[model samples]
Target chain A: MSLQIPDDRTPDGKPESEQPQWRRDFPIDWPEDNYISRRDFTRFLVLTSFAFAVGQTWILAMGSMGRGEDRQGRELVASVDDIPEGGAKTFTIKGTKEPFLLVRMSENTFVAYGQKCTHLSCPLIPQPEMGRLYCPCHEGAFDLQTGHPMMGPPRRPLPRVRLEISGNKVYATGVEDHRL
Target chain B: MPVPEHLEFFIDPNRCIGCQACVQACAECDTHRGYSMIQLDYIARSESPQTVPIVCMHCESPTCAEVCPADAVKRTEDGVVQSARKPRCIACNNCVLACPFGVPKMETPMELMMKCDMCYDRTSVGKKPMCASVCPSQALFYGARDQIERQRPRSRPIHRFLFGRQIIVTKVHLMVPFESPVAPMDVIAAFRETVIGHVFGPNFSAETMVGGGK
Candidate 1:
């Protein structure tokens, strides 16, 4: 595969190659970064579609009823190698509105929670370099370990999403009604 | 031998937020004569709002210059590929079709060919080009090699691109992941993968489509 690309641009100064098109929409690391095989790509698509289908059905079911409905089931969020320890990746569940962020704390422990600030439901940016998730909207911040509100206008702790790891794939099992 | 030093124009397509500040700023440059030389391209507009800015790659052997029948386009000593000059350009549109990077544009109203000149007026005076100057996300950053490397640690800047077998080297660089191949990236192959291979599993005989394995 490397044979296609040669480094012979030593004299004329070559311009940059365009980024992959999917990168613009997905905004995730390359398949190489995730160490994804062809099988994994298929799983990603199927699981994503399945999650979306289930979410749609849930919405239609709840629209006719008075009580709330629980968004149940597992969705593949990422592979284990997608992010290094202490780093985080944000993803959206099918049939849900809020985004969720997953943090890899150590070798075996990965924690996920809603990315929204409790104060205004603004998406919080994970700044692992600063050891806390920060919301630029109101200077709201949450601790990496506990998802507890550390400072600013947020009064409630960020909701946690239950996670299960199988093989090298990571799955988001269930989300709380609002936060997760 | 060392090439020209107008190496400051760097693009990180991933970092581009499609603000078009660069587009607005480029048209504002005094040298461009109120016409923006930069173009913003959307990958899949209906499906995605991602965009990347296009500027002259300033190829070492510029196809735009080679194919110009009137011989109007010129490459500066410092590696800037200037737009077709007024006296020589016939507005034939040959350069428009020949450029692999699709940087050149025909100004229909002016009856002339024009493209990014890296804002020679500002750069010659030791300043950044208009696009690089106003890019809000630093998608079009202008700096020395060391400066860019310091800013993007996880990514590597690449200047060589393989449009089929023709290796087109340019004055500017695109930042890609560090593990990317040293060989000029195969632009066409990547395009094919994005369009076809992703939609239909090419090797469907033995591979599992979902979960880990069958």
Candidate 2:
């Protein structure tokens, strides 16, 4: 019984040492047994630093990309009678779940606010008596008039969902943001 | 306004209604810049306690800057400890560990460090910090150290004393007497006696009060 040894050819029909050129210099200068080099470690640290810097640069770039918006024609939403003045409706626009409240501050006027609480994504409930919107999950409250927080855990004002009137129908055309 | 030497936020508990305005403002600013400045945490330490807003206190001597080996973090001239940028970070958790407030965080995968700089950039440009600007209750304020100190609730105690401690007072004050029935003649007599007594008292009241005041 004779024992035979196999050569260093990879099972995939390629020489084990003949990988792509990019990999040739990699492991850069790994010693015979050790898997990494000091140079490689330093390079890794430098690259990490570069990555951090690049992340900031990316942020500046994104900020300079400007805000995403378009001034155009309006879109149709619920009818005037559908919301019943001091009520809310959840709808999706541009693939985002935007909940808005339709408040009848007067007989002929309507105000709407994004229903999501600014605190922790809780849904806001209307407190008509208090003229505020309350979040049951966290007791967060927002003013119905300016969408500012009246009390509780909400910090930012509710993004005012723009509403356009088309004859007998009320439409949410877009949102007006005060955030810088 | 420039931040002070010691970075302590004057939280007006009276003005705080638990509205997370500062939280959303911070998150928005962070999202705009593609970084995380502030985040809302819902801790259930008590079964039914309401979630409260928390933010970086921006300490005077920041632990984040102390522990950063790469020196990527630094306190700005305006007293904000700002990270150079996300790409400058080395993914070391030293800053996170050094922060006594535990406000700094490093996200997974890339593990980039992130924390608040008190919106120093925005403030330097004459805009209010994101949190202070977005506060619906005007709870958060930004200004020069002195201005903020002045704007702080007036009820805080004045802990400083004027002049040296070796001064002594030779005079004393006496109560004045009133003609009304609620007042007494002894009070007036005591006042006159004290007035005369203080003029001839053991300590130098006139000199001491003068230097002590101004």
Candidate 3:
């Protein structure tokens, strides 16, 4: 017996010419395929958000892991008697390898600064003529008394440091990190 | 070209003290809403008079407006040049160098073009410019361009005479010096113009003060 070709096609079969126009716009050789279906785009956006969230979370985790309370790395800096009243000395404290300023304001009182001008991070030198801390780089001057901008180009104050003196010795405890 | 009221800022060299109080005051009052009035340096040589602070006088024909590739610098109806948005300025320094008054400054962190805006906000509120307000010596003033004209006769006669003479002679001097290359154009022009105008004229004896005769 001869089997004749079926007049009706299989189920869900449609002719190529009768196919919907949805896929026609997405042709090959297009420069950038920016167009995407709503479902596909939503999924992609969700994935991008997840990636950003992961990156932010990783940064936060690294930051939290780096800083710890109760720092115990204390060291002897200099002799307290070596620093005269209204005089300053240089020392490093707390994670920074750069030197900082330690000024003995009075006989028993002491103050310290990072010795860097905030405008250009230039080394601040003491100007006895003007009675201010001067930056030779941009002529930025900060008040010796208050660490505020007295003249020149500095926009922020020098970062202050914390110090402790016991008997005839000096110790650099930590930094105040005063930002302006 | 016909100028709109011939806008120009007349600076008196003898009066200015170069305190830079204008710079600080401008920073305080005009520096808000993401804008800052321009600040300038005070560079005075030994013989020169003290340097004075400057702002945009809103020229009748702004060189900045002509050279802007993006058309970002715009002049308001009241004749003030302002930057509409953060320009993708090529850092060409064309406007900076083209300006005769040297008002345009290159801002950092972006290296975009910057200049004065004439304190439009403060002026609108019936207050003087921040620079004028902060001037301790009362050296600065702002008003209609015509107001300065009326005040010039009484306040600044020598300046007006020199400025007018310079305006007239500069054009004539530009023509005489073609390709000699003996000296610079400015010096030769100034010397020739001064000597020729005053030295050999009718009633030249009456002008004894021209050559220290008086």
Over the stretch B1-214, how does candidate 2's per-residue lDDT look in tens digits? Answer: 5543333333333344556777767766743355546654433333433343445654433556545655456555444556534545688888886554457877656567777766666655666678767767545554444565565434231111111221111001111122223221121122233332123323446775678622
TM-score of each: 0.48, 0.34, 0.36
Interface RMSD of each: 15.8, 33.8, 37.2
lDDT of 3 by residue, A50-166 (tens): 999999999888857644233344467778778776777888765657668877767887666768887878888875445678899987888877778888888777765556777
Clashing pairs in 3: none
Top lDDT prediction, candidate number: 1
Prediction RMSDs, each to the true structure = 33.2, 38.2, 34.3
lDDT of 3 by residue, B89-173 (tens): 5666677765545577656556567677656676555566677777776456554446654654445311101221221111001
Model 3: DockQ score: 0.00
Clash count for candidate 3 is 0
TM-score for chain A, candidates 1 onward in order? 0.57, 0.58, 0.54
Error of 3 at B54 (Å): 2.1
Q: What is the lDDT of residue B83 in candidate 1?
A: 85
- State which candidate, 1 or 2, has the greater lDDT: 1
